[model samples]
Target: MSEKSSDTSGRPESSPESGDGAEAAPGSTPAAVSGAARVSPGRANAAATKPARASTAPVPPQDTGPDVPKVPAYLQTQPRPDVWLGKGPQPPGLLSRLRTPSPPAIGPATLWSVFATALLSALLLGDGLGPNLLIVAVPAALGAFFAARSAGRVLRPWTAVWAVGGMALLAVPALREAGWPVFLAVVSALALGSLALHGSRSWPGVLLGSLGLFPSVAGGVRWGWRGVRDRAGDSRGRVRTVVRSAAVAAVLLIVFGTLFASADAAFADLLGRLTPDVSVGDSPWRLFLFVLGAAGALAAAYSAAAPVRWDGITVRPGKARNRAEWAVPLIVLDLLFAAFIALQLVVLLGGYDKVREETGLLPAEYARQGFWQLLWATVLTLLVIALALRWAPRGGPRDRTLVRSVLGTLCVLTLVVVASALRRMDLYVDAFGLTRLRISVAAVELWLGVVLVLIIAAGVLGARMLPRAIAASAAIGVLAFGLLSPDGLIAEQNVARYDRDKRIDIEYLESLSADAVPALDTLPEPLRSCALEHFRRDLARQDTPWYASSWGEVRARDILERTPVQNHGSDCYGLGQEADERGGDEEEHSYDPY
Candidate 1:
């Protein structure tokens, strides 16, 4: 990757002979290249024969962005380095043809096929505003399949693992609400995996490739658009014929069908049935919108599956000239961590009572403190460890030992903090009640804990495969979690809590979407009836459209099993005699799930 160097700054550099057939020289500053041999006679004659300049006045230099590239050493030898320097007759002025931008290249056909798959999956997952895990997983799984299929020349095992793993993470929404954070995790992990799989030599390349998923997809779309434009002259193309025919047929059908429908009642009825009732709001807006949405999705899916070349984008740790330089700083850092660890141990032994006493706060308030901050601290510490290793000076065994010992110690200590955080959260939850955010954070902290364990195995124990193991574990964990069902878990936990403590909040349970109904069914007696009554009223009140009945909606609908009128005790769920008495003072009717 480091074989050739034209510029240290991230810019496109130019050489006098860059466009010429002349061999390239080593990349260096103008001063370093002053000693190179002069240009040959043929080049001189060609330059001499070039057309006269369009303007006699001196052309002002243009400044590119701040990270400007230095002119190649060879450029200094030329009287006018930016002038045309090729073998053939040239255009006048200093513009080098090499800087001409080329259009982005579209992905292989297989990639487009994958995008189509994602589009279909998106449609199947949901219709309107709510989040859908199925949508995330559908595209994710397809993206993984295609990523593996098109991963460039350098394929790492972790790449495939991460791609597949990322897809699994996307599946998390199937269990819980598909929050934006989960989507972020899905995209980032998938991008990282794809970049790693492509054997990106530099971290910058990995980052650019990952973040560029959207841009590249958009670029791919541009490329495809241009490609279509370029072939605009192709009158015989199948696409042209299809479009022309479809347009003509649409017009003819509209005109004649309108007339026919006006003239004949039976024929009009048949034609009306043929016309789809689908619309955004009594118009064809949703259809047009779906078309645009499908196009964007198609482009994104294809773009992600196919990445652009980013070989030059690289960033690496700067190794020190001597190992001794890293010694003192590393040792000092280790001591600080050691001290911190000692303090943490003391605190751990201090017992919950001491924390409660010192903090002078209730269990809920106390639990909230230190947990989030400590979690962030552990994350930053990992990043620090990474940075120290990356920018490390050459080190002897002692340095590695110190680094490893410190890292191992930190990992162990962080686990202590993680445990503390979990205990704190549990205490808080017990004192109060569970919420989506609380439960979700608990899962996230546990996942982070798993990540720390993998870091320990990789950093201290030198278990090379553990990083891949970590990725795999994360993906598998989310997938398993999703399959177990997050909404169901939350519902179960809160319901169980209510059972244990008699703190059921019927109104809050009622507010949850039907997704929570199946789990809420496990609730006993009046509470169960109370929760289901809301569903009973709403389900009976509004009709589900055929087109909008996604798998989630379908599942929730299935839980009703039967109409409320089928059974005598089917009195809509209630709150003992309170709700029953409120509802026309009816007797506290018996409630049965049956």
Candidate 2:
């Protein structure tokens, strides 16, 4: 025991009670003090808990005093509430937005919103708000929506209708005046909303946004007008076009105006007979129509030679050759067209002389004979087209500039011819009410002009140069021609020949009957002949040839519809009657039948 105790004493002390009894003695003293205090009720419990911990181990030096304050429960953080905590997993990507299998189909109500918007635009543009508003607005607006939604997609049929209609509306003057930038902004916003709400499937929504320009301006500016001046093409081609156009206009003005103006003098000298004035300028209407016709004819011919596609969004030529070689067919077509034009002049001049010699015709008779003139002219045009396919620029894989030059020359010449024809036809009586024929001629002419320029610019250079320059130039030319031409001046003239003729007939029938022949004789040979031919036709009351009937044969000759008709009774009679009735009440006038 003594040995063991000595060995243990030599080992490390485990506590203060053993040779380390210093720690245990202090702890035990505290416990004894606490036990004594515990004899006094509540304080005894606190002392008991303190004694147990102190007896087990000494306090660490790092510990702070027991007077530390407790933390408040309100300062603690709580767990977050999850919105989707219990929900099933969602689909990734865009599919997540969809709640059902099928997205909502655009219905009538939504479509109506588009239509209403478009119609409102048209009304502001002054495009005669009417029952056919759907026809006018649906295609443009829908097309635009689809174009924007699809970015660059083709649209379904219904979507197509809306896009096209919407585009038409945006083109109106009221919207265009708002500036294209703002217009486009609105379109983008509207398009986005439409896509979000209606979910269009059309690919052409991308294209319809492009249609914004179509409605505002017939030829949307591919590049601004300034672009037209900066870009260059075949330098020779440009200079040649400008020079040729100017020359043709000058020559035509001189030839047609001079020869026709001098027709009465020549008649008196050669046939020993006096005649009336034949000068084009004296009859502003005639001059105007002739120029318009010339312009129209040229435009139409060019259009036929180089057809436009996709409603002017783009131009793709009908021919299947390289553009360099395309000039071959175009040139041949031009030459043939030129020959046909020459033949027409001969026929017009020759036929005119014979009609003048037989002066018992009425205006109807003259018009009837004019049908033959038109027929022959059409045939000549067809023949020219045929010849082009056979001989000129046969496109047999040749590297040539002559074909291009020829085609370009023809294009220029066509403008000249159309202008000349319009001047000759006397389309407008005054500036406001367009004669049916003249209006039709003008419409066809203007549209063709637009198409020709597009064909040349797009088809010719589509694969080579960017179309921006050519498109802009063509657009400017078209706008200038439309707004500044004599046609516009006459468009403002508020008189109608039909109105005048009826007034003259009612007011001075006796005077007209007595002097009609002398007056007819005084007219230049062509006019006299035209008058005589009509007079005879009316007297004979012959049935108009069926083929001679206008495009809408039995349909009412609504000039607004742009239909051609043969022997369609002139609307002038009723119009004249109404005018006579209105004026007769103001001033007493004796009605006499000649």
Candidate 3:
């Protein structure tokens, strides 16, 4: 048998010398073979059974060099051949790439602004939270705003609105000395302002952007460092000259000032008074505050200028369920809510007597028992509405109508639950004088009612603006809460309760900050002396700087100064004796203002 040839198509070809009494097909192979031809058994079998077509193109010579393995089909599409083969340097990781600084360096003007803000923070914040907080916060916010503007970033109308709101919240510490309100107000202001700066639109985006502030602060530091490094090379000569001049000037001033002070005693006194007394121990703290302020401001400006497009991050909705599947459970829930509301209506009208007869508890006690559960129910209802909306079918008009009807009814029922919760809190407060916890919970319940209303409005109109509206409402609620002064309100309520019932928690009043002083000062003789004593001593001892003096503290001090306590002693109200008699059985309640 003659050797068989193969074609580029990998098919075996018949040879004319093959003595099988079969002639070769016309043009079955090329006229001149390019290489030693060999065919696998499989190809030979196929070629023997099937005829081949004539070749149209000349065959190229095969390589006789050392064989190189071909890349697998999957590997051929790889972006980096060396990487795929585990050869050469591997690329940096996702984190490394993220850490690497990108362009739009901090400009000199912005840097100077950051420096001034930092310096102001170091000087003013050292005293504590007060007008100093407002002073530092305003400039920092303005610096960020202006820096962003200078960098050609657009400032939306809402940006200015949020900025003003944040500044107003920051002023809470300046106006009120209550620790809880000030802390809450300041924290809310920061989080909301961060969202505003980044222009977050959706609820998820707002949450993520608020959290992104920390990383942004860190990135801002790195960004500022890079800007400084890039500019250092260009300004090396000028920096060196400036440093040398500063050092020489410092030495000359020290030497001549000492000589002049020695020559004149009055000059020495004046110099001593003028010079700042900064201890080495305090320098690090001051430096920390400065860096913190600078980092925060720079982060805000950086975020405002080149905001991460958090709103652009699309969250895939859950697969839409059939209208019946989505709406059925919600409808059932609404029915349950409606039944509960109907029962609540009975109680609201006059059935409290029946409840008391069955439970052997007063109306207030009954209200108190279910208040927390009702609050949680309202919260969970809102959550359910959110989830239902997420998974509701996006079919034709009918599906949408179903969604609106079911969810809107549920929301309306939830508003009644919120009202019940607030009414419960009111009854409890009326029965036993208002405490911070009672008032705070009442405020939260009221805000929940407001949210339900907003949700209803969204369902009526469109849900596109609902998230922003909800967020704005929350900000407004917090602002109103802080501005109203929860501590002051608590004191006023207790005082009024005392006027009505001739009973008050003097011990609790004593624990309140200066925010309650004005209210507490209105009490009668010994009670006034008892309630005002703590603040009187506190304000007298607090030698705060002018910048750090809060309006509450200032007013308290003025009031106490003008009307000094007639009776002052640790046992002014026999509170210790009362506590001893009670065996210290008072329940200590800790509340989270958030």
Stretch of 10 with least lDDT, candidate 3? 585-594
Q: How many backbone clashes does candidate 2 have?
A: 94
Q: Give the candidate number with the greatest lDDT.
A: 3
Q: What TM-score does candidate 2 get on C-alpha atoms? A: 0.29
Top-TM-score structure, candidate number: 3
TM-score of every candidate relative to the true structure: 0.59, 0.29, 0.76
List, residue by residue over 106-148, the lDDT tens digit for candidate 3: 7776776777789888777876788777777766677677657
Give the TM-score comparing model 3 with the true structure, all chains together.
0.76
- Model 3 clash pairs? none
Please report how far candidate 3 places residue 92 from its true position, in Å: 9.5
Regions of model 3 farther than 4 Å from truth: 1-103, 236-277, 349-360, 568-594
Evaluate model 1: give its lDDT.
0.55
C-alpha lDDT of all candidate models, in order:
0.55, 0.36, 0.74
For model 1, the stretches where C-alpha displacement exceeds 4 angstroms are: 1-126, 129-163, 166-206, 229-237, 240-277, 280-306, 309-312, 318-366, 460-481, 534-552, 561-594
lDDT of 1 by residue, 1-594 (tens): 232222222223323434322323567667534544444445444544454343344433433458757888977675645546566665843212211134233333533444454444344333432234334345444543443355343445755555556555554444333344345455545555455433343444444544544544454456556544555545348666767998999999999999999999999987764444443463344445445544544444444445454545445556653555555665676677667667656445565576667666555666766668767866786787677667665457766676677567767777777877787777667655666677777887888888888888787567546544654566566566555555566677768766665555565566666567777877776567667777767766655333333344456666775424123254543343353233331221211111
